[model samples]
Structure formats: structure tokens, C-alpha cells
Target: MAAVSKYLTAKNSAAAGGILLVLYFLKQRRRSAALNRKKGSANDLNSEKDGKKERAAVDKLFFVRISRIIGIMVPRLLCKETWYLFLIAVMLVTRTYCDVWMIQNGTMIESAIIGRSTKGFKKYLFNFITAMPVIALVNNFLKLGLNELKLCFRVRLTKHLYDEYLNLKKIITGHYVDHLHNFIFFRFSMGMVDSIIAKYFATVVGYLVVSRPFLDLSHPRHLSSSHAELLEDYYQSGRMLLRMSQALGRIVLAGREMTRLSGFTARITELMRVLKELNSGKYERTMVSHSEKDVSEKLTLVPGSGRIINVDHIIKFDHTPLATPNGDVLIRDMCFEVKSGTNVLVCGPNGCGKSSLFRVLGELWPLFGGSLTKPERGKLFYVPQRPYMTLGSLRDQVIYPDTHEDQKKKGISDQVLKEYLDNVQLGHILEREGSWDVVQDWMDVLSGGEKQRMAMARLFYHKPQFAILDECTSAVSVDVEDYIYSHCRKVGITLFTVSHRKSLWKHHEFYLHMDGRGNYEFKPITTETVEFGS
Candidate 1:
């Protein structure tokens, strides 16, 4: 009777532990789900209509996205990742078997003590001691395999993303910016949820198992062989039940991990889809205007488009409408022509299509009306208001967009580059920064005026037939700017200058003026024109 009562007590304790574990896991899952819904609601409210549509698509095809991502990460059946996964599965099975053996051996140890059999106790204890190393080895090996698998997934996925993103055939600047924003936001939001759930589970599990009570052996009750055997069976069965509950809890946690993976899969799949569309020359953007008519039209490509022709030695735009990427038409009809050595000055109000015209000429924005004729790609160059500093040595600052080999192919040595720098009065930077090989964060290291001068040097190094100077020398002194202009004319390079400075009027042969109302005049630059314009 005592043995039966003790067996019942042990059985009840194990059942209670299992129940508590399950209840805790359930509570955590509910809490996580509630938090997710709250966050998702806030995101939906702040997101744009396009974002909402994308989210809907992602949710609707969650499983399909997961499969696509899995295909990318593990491309082949005979890959190393597959072998790692197989080994991990084997280790898991081995660990489960070891756990079962340890549980049974523990119950036997307890029985031996209860029956006062020293030989049985010593034998079972030896078995437990012998199995501990094997269990530890299996556990560690499983962890190593999992880490390796994760690394392989990351490497493969990153490589695939790079291939799509950096493909030269269909690169879109605005699309990349949008995709980056989505990637960051989704990862952060989903990663937070996973982190919170994992930490909560770990804390609860630690506290629950911190002071587990062993079998009550203070008062041993001897029993018949049958009762002892039956008691051992009961104890082992209870322990196995507790282990099963723990395993189920782990499975639930893994499901949470899968939820996070689904988020990642959605983001990656969306990126791939967008890239494919861009490669095919199809693009979509939210219309800035909220007109019902505009929404109804819903043009996939930029509306009212035109044609582009590549020619040599001249650039002409015949009735091209300057439009922004957001479908805001800046100018209805723009017509201008410039040949080699013809310098033109552009002046206008703040939003009056001064830069927009240049963007069309450069093919940065789509030509959205009449025909455009420009010199082949290498004959034209652009210098923006703010210059971009490449990541390389001082020599790279001058010979930008060209490698040392390219410079060598042109038979222009570093000494020639130095002369180009001197034309812009930046020759002393080599001695100041120690040598041509010295590299630093040039953007932060150089002042605004120095950066502008370096950009001019880069222009001189390239020496294209036509250069669009969009207020690029805003930070330079009038004297240095004049010298730069004289050097450009000396080199026979045509200029389309975008500036409102009175000092820049003398260098250009013609002036193109734009009013904010889309009216424009292209006329010769004279004393009357400059004074009247001022």
C-alpha cells in the first residue's frame, strides 16, 4: 500500500510539472500574438496604399514565398547543407534516445536505494555515468550542425540578392532605395517579436527548473519484487510524459521561429519580384497627385513618353516634356540644341525645371514627350551640386569612373593628373595628405570648397565633349570659378551651366530662362539680356 501511494505521489508531481509547462507556453504564445496584432495595426495605419497591397500579397502567398526562399538557400539536393541537415536529424534522434535511457536509469537508481540493494545501485549509477559523455557529445554536435546550416543559408541568400541587385542590365536607383526601406523595417519588426518570445521562454524555463525536487528517499519502504517493478514502471512513465510535454513546447517555439522566417521570406520574394519587373522595363510608383482621373488612368509606364536617339557631337531636345518620377509634369514642351563648344547658361526659379531638363538630357529621367538627340554616352558628363567621393586613394579622386588601367590606356600618367589638379588649384593635397596612396573618408575629411575643387579636377581628367555643371562650384570663390570656366573653354568642352550668379554670365554664349509657370525663353546672352534678367 505504501509503495502504491508513493507511486501515485510521484505520478501526480510529474503530471503537474508537465501541465504547468504547457500552460506557460500557451500564455506566452497568446501574449506574443497580441503584441504582433497591435504592432501590425500601427504599421498598417502608417503605411502607404502600395505597402498595404504588398502586405496582403505577402500574407496570401506565405507558403509559396517560403518554398521559394528554401529553394534559394538550398539550391541542390546533394549540397553540403543537405548533408548537414541529415546529420542534425540523426543527432536529434540519438539525443532523444539518450534522454530516455537516462530517465529509466534514474528510476532504477531510486528503486535500488529503496530496496537497499547496493549492487543494483552501483550498476545503474555506472551506466548513468557512462552515458553522460555520449549525451553531451550529441548535444554539442547538434548545435554545431545547426550553426553551420544557418551560415550556409545566409551565404547563399546573400549571394543571390547581390546577383539580382547589382546586375548591370537593369539598375534602378529609386527602386533600390524603396526596397532597402522595406527590408530594414520588416526585419526589425519581426526580429523584435522573435527575440521577446525567446527571452520570455528562456526565463520561465530557468525559473521552473532551478530547484527541482528529487524523489523523496528520506524514508524508504521495502516492497515485494512485483510492487518494486510496478513502481519503477509508473515512475518511468511519468518522466516520459514530462519529457514529451517539454518536446511539444520546443515544437511550439520552433513554430514561432518559422513565423519569423516567413517574414524574411516575404521580404526577399518581394525584392525578387520588383527586380524582375524593373529588368523588364516595367515600374510602379504611388502617384503624388490624388486626382480621381489620374488614379483611374493608372499608367504603368510614365505617361506621354517620347524617343531618344544617340548621335555624335551634338545634343538636341525637340519638344520634350520634363516630368519627375512621381508624374509631376514640370514643363510641357522643352526644345533646345547645343553643339560642341557652344556654352549655354540655365537660370530659373527654384522649381522651374532647371535640373529637370538636364536629367532628361542625361537619361536619368525618362523622356516624356518629343524626340531627344544626344551624343553617345561617354561624350557627356554631369557634375551635381554635391560631389560623390569614391572609396580609394587620392589619385582616384581625379580619375574617377576610370581605373588606373583606363588612365594608362589613355597614356595619361599621374603627372598629367597632377597638372589637371593644378588647373583647379588642388595640387597641394598630395603633400598635405602624405601621398597619392593615402586613403581616408574623403567626404568627411575634405571641406565643402575642397570637395568642389576636387570635383572640378575630376572633370578636367575626364575632359568630355559636353559637361553639365549644375551649381557644382557653389562653394568655390569667384576667382577660382572663373579659372575653372576658362580652363573648360580652353579644353574646347561645351558647357550647360545651371546657376543664377551674375558672375557666371560672361562665360556663356546663350541663356535659357525658365519661369515657374512652364514658359521659357532661349536667347543669346548679351549685356541687355543679363541686365534685364537681373
Candidate 2:
């Protein structure tokens, strides 16, 4: 009887120890949870402060910038991008529903296994397997839709930028001024803000509340199920909460991504602003003045006082002030004129407004103050020392700035093009390069002399009224240059030759000489008047 009583006491002691251990563990868990909550609150406060600072640094007109970018991405409401975005939304909703269903299905399966119900387990397992394929399809399609949407956005933005960049007329018209103004005045209504908030509110609240109910699973009577069933429910609830947290984490990550996107948006918008300013013929230059009094003229726009008149068969410049783009006066006042069939040789010392004169004539540089007259566009062609070689076939070299279709429209055949090449002594290239359709990197492939001759061939093909040969034959031999000059005379193409070569004086009727100073002289090129060295 004493041995039996001792065994009972030992058993009671073990039971008491087990109870104390359980109570200690429960207290420790509560303490850990409290510490975690405190850390989380501190982190939340820090994150909120950081987010506000980042937002302030991003842009004051952040929404306007976003709206403009969105406008560029989706010019039309019923576009392909819109369709893809809709599909992505649908997929996200479907995925969320599938997640919920999966959680419930898993709970059923777990309950079946705990109860040792073989039929129920098999039924739930089959359901899980069947649903997997559908889930996989949804996931892949979602990825595809997202990628396509990205591509569409990229294409749209690129095309928009190219349009603004490439269209010279649009840039010159100052259209971007209005666009910038519109962006500044862009209104972000309260209703729209409310709508955006409303869209995400449900998702955020749902995620936050998802784990709340599962946390208090101490009472099995709250659920109309057995203890095993309650355990399965609790397990599934935990898994669902984990998934919800992951989704919430992605949302938070997206906020960081948006912060990065704001940087890119700011850069793009700044670039657009600069381009618009340039398009409107406005430029900013930091002028370093020689004297302190001239500091007020640090930046100035070119005065729009120049007029260009397009008249056939005559070129003239009246009181034109030749200036560089930096607002430096190259020539204060200049007057010149040449009628049809009058070939003038332009000669000047370095930086003496020689090229600047032609730049004004070509409308490339803004005319500061002048009344200039020139032949209509396409009637005047300038061939530089280094001619441009386009990317295309051998035939394209001769008829540059004109396509094969344009050549055909002008009733010029490959045979005629060959004749032009032959005139420039480049006809052999056809045989060497295979055929007219053979394409190569012409700039790298052709020699410098060949490129000049090719430009001459292009000149012959177009047969302009006046051609500015700016040392275009420097690379070619004297004989080839003579042939090219004779051919120009034969074709009745007047030439404004800029050269120091004495042999070219015979081909020109007039000489325009500019000293390194602002002074210049325009005179008839005669035997007695022609100065050999000077």
C-alpha cells in the first residue's frame, strides 16, 4: 500500500510540472508577440515618414506627369493595351478566388485524413489535381498579358517620342508650348482620386482582416466541427493568411517600384521640356562676357527679324548679319546677289563667315536680321568635302534622298543611273558590288574619292539649278575634277564653288573674297582682276 501511494505522488508531481511548463511557454509566447507588435509599429512609422519624404522629392506635379505618360501610352480608350489591362485585372480576380477555393479544399482534405475517411480524401485529392491545370493556365495567361501590356506601352511611348523628335515642322511650330501648358493645368479631380482609393481599399482591408479570425481559434464551439476538423480549419486559415501577407508584400514592393518610375518620369518630362524649348527656336547659352557691364546679356534668344523669299532663278542676301548659334557676330552686315547662270566662287580665310553665309542661305541657321532670296527647295544642292553615304543598294547612292519609286516616277531607269555613275567614273562599282540591289555599309566600304564622285553622280541625277561644291573634289584627281566641272557646264548647272584651287577660276564668272576681318569684296573674275596669290 505504501509503494502504491508513492507511485501516485510521483505521477501527481509530473502532472504539476507539465502544467507549469505549459503556463511558462504561454507567457513567453505572449511576451514575444508584444515585442513583435512594437517592432512592427516602429517600422510602420519609419516607412510612412520615408514614403512622404520620397514623394515630396519626386515631383510637385507627379500626377500630371503620370497623366501625360498615361495619355501617351493609351491614346485611345478601346486600344489593345486597354484590352490587355482588362484581362490582367480579370486574371487577378480569378486567381484570388482560386486561392480561396484552394484553402477551403485543402481544409476538407485535411479533415478527411484526420477522420480516416478514405472516400472523402480521394474526392478532395481529385478536386485538387483537377483544379491545378486550370490554375496553371490562368497563371501563364496572366504573365503573357502582362508582358504584352509592357510591350504595347513601350511601343507607344517610343513612337510618341520619335514623332516629337523627328518632325521638324512640328518642332518649328512651337506646339509643345501648348502641350506643356496643358500639363501644368491638368486637373486631378477629387472624384478620380476617390476612385483610385476605392479600387485598392477592398484589397487592403481584406488582406488585413484575413488573419484576424484565425488568430482566435481557442474555442472549438465557435465552429460546428469536431476537434480534428477545427485543427484542419486552423491550419488552412494560417496558410490563407500567409498567402494574403505575400500579396500585401507585393503591393508594398509596387510602391517602391512606383518611386523608381517617378525618377524616370521626371527625366523624360525634363527632356521633353527641353526639346519643346528647342522646337520653339528658344535656346539658353551661358555667355561669358569680357566686361562686368555685359553680364545682363548672359542669355538671349535670336531675334526673329529675318525674312526668306522664295524666288525662281535668283539668289540674294540683303543686309544679312551672319551670326553663330552662340550669338557671336561673324559678319555684322553683308549684301550679295547672283542671278541664274552666274557662277560665283566664294573664298575666305578660316572663320570668316564663308560656311556661315551658306548656312543662312540654306535656312539651317536662324537668320538674325536680313532679307534673303533663294531658289525654292530642291533647286539648290550642296555637296560637301565628305559626302553622306546612305544605307542601301548601289543605285541608291546615285539617287540619294530619292527612293527607287521616286526614281521610277521621274522616269529614270537603272540604265540612266548607270550613265550618271559612268559620268562620275563609278559605273564599275555595279560589277564589283554584284548588282544594283546589293546593299552594303557604303560609308565604310567606299573610298573617300569614291564617295565624292558618288555625290557628283547624285548631283547629276538631280540636276539642280545651282550646286555649291564645297571642296567636293578635293579627294578626286585633277582630271576627274575637270571632267566633273565640264559636265556641270554641259548640263547648264551653275556652280558656287568654294575652293582655293586656281584652275577652278576659269569655270566661275565672279569672285567673292572675305578677309579674316569682317570686310569682303565681290567682283567679276577677269584676267586682269584675278589675283593669283592674294
Candidate 3:
């Protein structure tokens, strides 16, 4: 009668498991369908970018998709490491099981070790040896899989962080403005935030480790009644420690989040201050005091790079009491000329405002105490020190600031594109589909030299009449640097470059030097000769 009841129970358990298997398969199929649909829709980006606003929208959507994957994968992966520490626990369980069974007769050593002498000891040793390989193999396999999975997850997470940094870097590089202070603050604050979260995660894992032993009991009253009661209390203390750890981790996370929030709040306040001064017209009276001169009518033209640069004076701000005597002339005057066939090299030591002058010319930042003429806008393109890479394809980065029609009109052929990459040496990366769109794990794919070379490739594609190469080739090797300068010189791009290299000096026909005391000198390169000291 009992055997019949046991057979029925076994059949019921098997049927329940079969139902679960069917449901799991159905769920997996649904997920695959959703992913395929998204991937299919993602393929038509080029056709959809018909308008300016639509293109911008598509660009944003492209970034959001990459970011969404990163966001989902990160927290899940970080939490998964705690499972590794759990493997140690399974060992203790096996040991406890052996200890319990051995105690069923007398104390383990009394009968098993002493009564039968060598025979009993051999049996025990053989048992351990027989089970040892199985235990070690299981543990080793589990650890190997976990390590490989962790490594893969870690690589993916690192890639995501780089993606986030690159995206934010683009916005930070607006107008080529110097935002060194802002960058420091941003990285420092975010770093603290990341640290806090990771520490909290570790704390949570520690708590689980301390408490899991208490919760894993098969029977509560196995020992002598008093002994069992004492053991329960002893293990229950582990749970209390876990609860305390959880509380501490939560508190730390909350505090760290508040600190980051404050940093953002301070940025808003600074922007508001700038706005209020502008709205209040704080500089209007000062700007008008210069005899009410017509800055526009004082236009001058030095035709170079297919455009005219009209400005009376360029200066370096002294930022000292003597330079600003009436608290008026904060900067000194500089004059220069440019002809159609010359490259203008702006050279100075670090922080001498070489980059700032480019921004003034680019019309990104306002020029102090001077009037600049309006040139045809599309003829100019500014390349900064660090090339800004976005979350898109190589095609997108290459054709920036130009429309699809413009690209076609400019005659960008496959051969041209491939040749340009080959010149800069980034051809292999672009060969892979979605290589540019592929989220990068590290900027190391291109070395400093490679990045600079790649930037030059973009320069080749754009073929802008005027190119501002502002330390844009610093990371490039000296050989590649000379090659780029040689090419630009040959092409007659009318370059305005800032470099510390003497090798590069020969390529330019004009020069400018700024001393930080608000003093500057501008000269035609034809009249100057610089010799290294003997």
C-alpha cells in the first residue's frame, strides 16, 4: 500500500517540473523576438536622417541605445561577484555532514580510529581520497566558469564607462573653451560616487557571507537538547551582524549620493551668476567708452584659407595691475598678415593663450577689444587638441558639420575613404561593420599617435579651406607629424597651427609669440631665422 502511494507522489513531481520547462522555453522565445525587432529597426538610420532636427534626434537615439545596454549590464554584473565567496561555504557543509554521520556511534576517533587500528584508519583515508577528486573537480570547474564570466563582464563594464566618458567629453569640449576646472570637478565627483556604490556592494556581500551559515540548517534539534539550543543562538548572532552591515552600507550610499548632488547644484549657481551679469549690462558702459568707434567699418582682409580675417589687434591679457592701468586695457595689441599660400603657425609655451586665440578666430568665444569680420561660415572647421569621438560609425565622425549631399558633392568615394584611413593607418578598424558604433572598451585601440593620425584623416576628408590644428597632432609620432604638415602644405589648406616642434616651424610662412605679461609679437616667417644654441 505504501509503495503504491510513493509511486504516485514521484509521478506528480515529474509532471510539475515538465510544466516549468515549457514555460521557460516560451519566455525565452518572447525575449528573442523583442531583441530581433529592435535590431531590425536600428538598421535604417541613414534613410531616416532626412532633416537637420531628425538627424540630431537619430544621433541621440543611437547613443541612448548603447547606454541602455550598459546601464542594464553593470549593476547585475557587479552584484554577481558575491557568489564566488559562496563556494567556500559548500566545503563546510560537506565537512559537517561527515562529522554528523561519524558521531552516530561513539565519538569518531574512539571506534573508527582506535578500535580497528590500521584497518579503520585505512578505510577512513580511502574514503577521503575517493571523494577528494570529485569535490576538487566540482569546485575547480565552478571557479573557472565564474572567473571567465567575471572577466567578460568586467571588460564590458569598462567599455561602458569609457562610452559614458567619451559622450560627456564631447559636450565639455564646446567652443574649444578651456574647462580644466570643470573636468577635474566632474571626474572627482563621479569617482567618489562610483567608489561609494562599490563599497556598499562589498558591505552587502559581507553581510550575506556572515549570515548564510545560520539560515542553511537542515535540522534545528540534532545535537543534545541544550547543545542544539546554544548552537542556534550562536549562529543567530551572525544574522544580527549582517543586519548591521546592511544598515551601514545604506547610510554610506545615501551620504555619497548627496555629495554628488551638491556638486551639480553648485554648477547651476555659477551659470546663473554669469547670466545675471549679462542681463544687467555690466560691460555696456565700458565697451561704449572707447570713443564709440565703429568696429565694423574698421574691417581689414588678409585673404588666406579661402576667407578673410579682419581684426585690428590680437592681444595677450596681462591680468596684472600695471597692464590694466585704468582698469581698461586688459590686453595688448598684435597685428599680422596672411596670404593665400602660407600656413600661419601660432607658437607659445603652455597656457600662453595659443588655443584661446583660435577660439577667438573661430568665433566660439568673444574676442576682447577687437572686431572680427564675418567670413563665409562653411569654409572653416576647427579641430581641437583631442578629437571628439561620438557613439556612432566612422562615417558619422568623418562627415560631421557636413550634410550627406555635401559629402556626395565633395566626392567622398569608398576608395577615397579607405585611402584616407590607410594614410592615417586606421583602415583595419573601419573595415568591421559598426566598428565606429561599437562601444569601445579603451581609448588604447588607437595609441596617442594613432588618434592624432586619425584626426588628420578627418582633416583630409573635410578638406576645409582653413584648418585650426591646435596641438591636434601632439600624440602623433614626429615622422607622422611631418607627413601631415607636408600634406597640408602641399594641399594649400591655409593652416593656422600651434605646435612646439621646430621641425614643424619650417612649414609655416608666418609666426606669432605671446609673452604672458600681456605682450605679444607677430611677424612674417620670411623675415625670421631661429637657430639652436651651440
Candidate 4:
């Protein structure tokens, strides 16, 4: 119990220190800003205004922070399995009473020794020995209950954060789990500290009541006995000093821990505020066109289409007067359309809007002035330069975005999945890892080429209407790349691929070349175009 108390105290002190540091930093920044404003510079004033708004937002969230902390604690405590909480309360109450009784007995033993009374000493000593076993048993059980409570709190808090605020990727690590546990544990420790202080204070008060006669500053008019007086004086002085020292220590410790608690509340409040903003979509990027003229010259939205993708009178103008999400205009007055079951190869130099054009088509980047017609969301899929592999087995990797139920509904057999893997020449993975159920840290395990090939395998599984291969095959050899493209074509999946490889031109029917200097040319891939190599 003493070891546990010490550990909690250290953690509380550290939390208080963290809060202090954050507040200090914030104070320093405000002071610096004030000094700069006093210099009477317009630029300084403008910068100050921006910074002050952010600071004010943070300041205003203190109440919200407290609310968030309460939110983390209350629901879990009041939850269905609140029996754990009841058990903890009972344990704490038992532990507190036991502590007080032991302290009282200890004080009596001290007085007995000082008085040199053999009989009194033996009586207190027998009481102490008898209580020791029960106290030990209670302490052990209390510790066990406290640990279980911490685990319960951790699990609930983790669910809240993961399900509501943050995604799985950010909070998957053991470090994050420990962070959640510490947050709840600190509050529990504060209650323990309070109980300890109250017990000690009550003990000291009881001693003062009994020793009031000797502690009176005034000299006694009628003495009891000279020897009694000496003993009383000695006891009074020592007890007063010890109580004062203990009180001072408790006050300092409590104040420090409370400060840390405040700090923790501040940090958590800020996080909740951010999460709220994210949930409200307040931080989502605003899509603005390069030119006001371009915004006004909106192309008519094509009524509807069964085509895989369409680009109608798409004019990507220069971003001279204003900045766009895509830095500068690389393709000017670009216009093209890919009907159903047709592939277009987008070719451009570095910094040209090859990928940017695809982003616009995919509705990721803002369309400057054009009618971009595309199929529904699930109908289109993009294969980036780096494919993301989520934490799951190889089966999950193949039929991604599709749950096992969905796969079962579609009647997708393991044999079919293996064949898809075979298409990407990754059939060896099956034999090496034993089966499709084997899970691996694929990001570290797979080579760049292998990862891209795996991505291709995934594409084969989904087989969307159009797949934007954005340099997805750069690391892939020419033969494998050819095979992947051919396979997609055979699957009736129209492709809008961005690549610098000259070998890629033969796979598509037409070419859309971007000149980086706001000019574009589009035409069928001619026999003469086959000679050029990037």
C-alpha cells in the first residue's frame, strides 16, 4: 500500500508539472505578443489579433474541459457493471477505518514506551499484533480492487475515444492505452490522498484534545508533579511539531496534485474541443477556384451519364491572382471525355497537373471551371503511389472495404481470391504464409513492388468502373505492369492512369499531355508517339 501511494504521488506531481508548463508557455506567448504590440507596428497588431483569437478559444474551453472529464468518468461509473465501483467504495471505506485504528494504537504504544509502563506497553503491543493480520488482508484486497477499477475505467475511456473522436490507426499502440489508464488513475489517487489527509488530521486533533493542559502557553498555577510536568511538556512539544510538519506536507502535496489535475483537465478539454470541431466538419478544406471569372463561368452539369468518367469543357486556368489547393495551373483549357469501356493515359512532366487532374475528376480537388461527370462513390476506386494496408489478415487485404459478410453474400470463394493473387504473381505468399488467414505487418513485410502488386490484387477484387492508377506501377516491372493493365481491361474496368512510363502509352486508347506551363494537348495515341520515352 505504501509503494502504491508513493507511485500515485509521483504521477500526480508530474501531471501538475505538465499543466504548469503549458500555462507558463501560454503566458509567455501572451506577454511576448503584448510587448510586440506596444512597438506600434501594424503587422505586429495583425499577428497579435490572430494569435489572441486562438488563445481566447483555448481559454473559453476550460468549462468544456471539465465537462469532458466528467463525461469520461460519470457514464462509466453509472454503467451496467457499476458493481465494480461499489466494491471499490467498500474497499476504500474499510481501508480508511483500518488506517485510523492502526494510527491510534501506534500513538498509544509510543506513550506507553515513554511512560515506561510494562503493563500498558504489553497491552498496546498485543492489540497491534492482533490487528496486523486483518490490516494486511484488507490492504491486499483494496489494492486488487483498485487495479480492477483502473482497468474498467481504461476500457470504457478507450471505447469512447476510439469509437467517437479518433480512428483506430491513431490509438492502436500500447502507449496510448497506458495514457488512458493514467488519466483515470490520477483521479482515483486524489480521493485516496484526501482520505489519508482526513485520517491524519483527525488523529492530530484527538491528541491535542488530550494534551490540551500541557499545551496551554500559560504556566500552570498548581503543579501536578515535577516528573509528570516534564513528561507532559516533552509529549506536548513533540506532538505539536510532528502534527505541524505532517499538516504542512499534506497541504503542499495536495496543492501540487490539484494543480496537475487542473493541467490534465486543460489538455483534455482542448482535445475534446478539437474533436468537436472535426465532427462538425469545421476544419474541412474549402474548395475555391483560381479565378473569380472561372467561378462565374461554370459549365453546365451534364444531366446524367452511364459513362465511367467524363470531362466536359474543363478549363484549368492559371492560379496567378489567388492560390489553389493544387499550387499552380499545369493544364490550361483542358477538355476530354472517356466513355464507357475506354482507357485514357495521362502523361505529363513533374509538377504538371497529371495527378491534380485526376484529383479534380475524383472530386478530391476543386474543379476550377468544368463539368466533371463521374459514377457514384463506390463505383470509382483510386490506386495511389503508396497503397495503405490496414491491420488484418491477407483475406481482409484482398476484399478491402468489404466485410466478411459482404464477401459471403457475394459468394466469393477462397479459390477465387487465390487466383487474384496469382494474377499479381504473389502466389508464393500463399505457400509462404500457409493460408489466407495469416496476418502480417504487411507494411514492413512487403517490398515496394510487392505492396503495389498487392494493391493490384485488391483492385482485381473490387473491380470498380474506373481506377485511377497514380504512378501505382512505378516500382512494378514493365511486364507485370502490362499484365495488370491487361487484366483490368479484360475485367471491363475503364482506367484513367497517370504515369511517366513510355511503355504505358500502348495500353490506353488516347493521350492527354500536360505541358506544366498552362497548356494541354489531347489526341489519339499515334504510332509516332510510341517512340518517346520518359
In candidate 4, list every pair of residues with a backbone clash.
Answer: 16-260
Question: What digit string (tens of lDDT, one per residue) describes model 1 on residues 278-360?
Answer: 44556655334232335464323343247878887788889876667666656666788888878999888888888878766
**Candidate 4 TM-score to native:** 0.55
Question: Looking at candidate 3, what is the lDDT of residue 232?
Answer: 43
> In candidate 2, what are the lDDT values of residues 1-534, reduced to their tens digit?
333333333255336434644554456447546766766666668975654322212345777887888998998989999999999999999988988898899889988988899999999999999999999999998999999999999999888777665432211347888887665664344234333433354244434344343344543434567678567856775686466545544543454366568877877777677556655756544333222345464433353357788998889889876666556665666788998788999998777778887766776666666678888767999999999999898888889999999999999988898898899898889878878999999999999999999999999999988889998988888888899998998997989988888778888889888885657888998879755532
Winner on TM-score between 1 and 3 is: 1
- RMSD (CA, angstroms), candidate 3: 19.3
* lDDT top scorer: 1
Worst 10 residues of 1 by lDDT: 207-216
Error of 3 at 422 (Å): 3.2
Tens-digit lDDT track for model 4 on 141-195?
8787778867876776667655554321111689999999998897788567555
Error of 3 at 165 (Å): 21
Model 2 residue 264 CA deviation in Å: 7.0
Which residue pairs does candidate 3 place in steric collision? none
Residue 342: error of model 4 in Å? 2.1
Sorting all predicted structures by lDDT, with the top scorer first, yields 1, 2, 4, 3
Tell me the tens digit of each residue's lDDT in model 3 across 1-534: 333233333245336434643554455446546755665555466444542121111134444544554453554643554444355356456645543443332233233443456776676666666766766766576667567656855676566544543322101577445577777886798567546543554354444444443344433433334443344444454444445455544554553454444443344333444334433323222221121145333222111111234432222222111111112332345445455556777766665567656644554433344334434445566777877754445665566655557778977775786777777667877775445445453245556666667778888887766777887877777777777778876766678887776777777877777665455666766644671211
- For each of the candidates, the C-alpha root-mean-square deviation to the true structure, in angstroms, is 9.3, 15.0, 19.3, 11.8
Per-residue lDDT for 199 in model 2?
38
Per-candidate count of clashing residue pairs (backbone under 3 Å): 0, 0, 0, 1
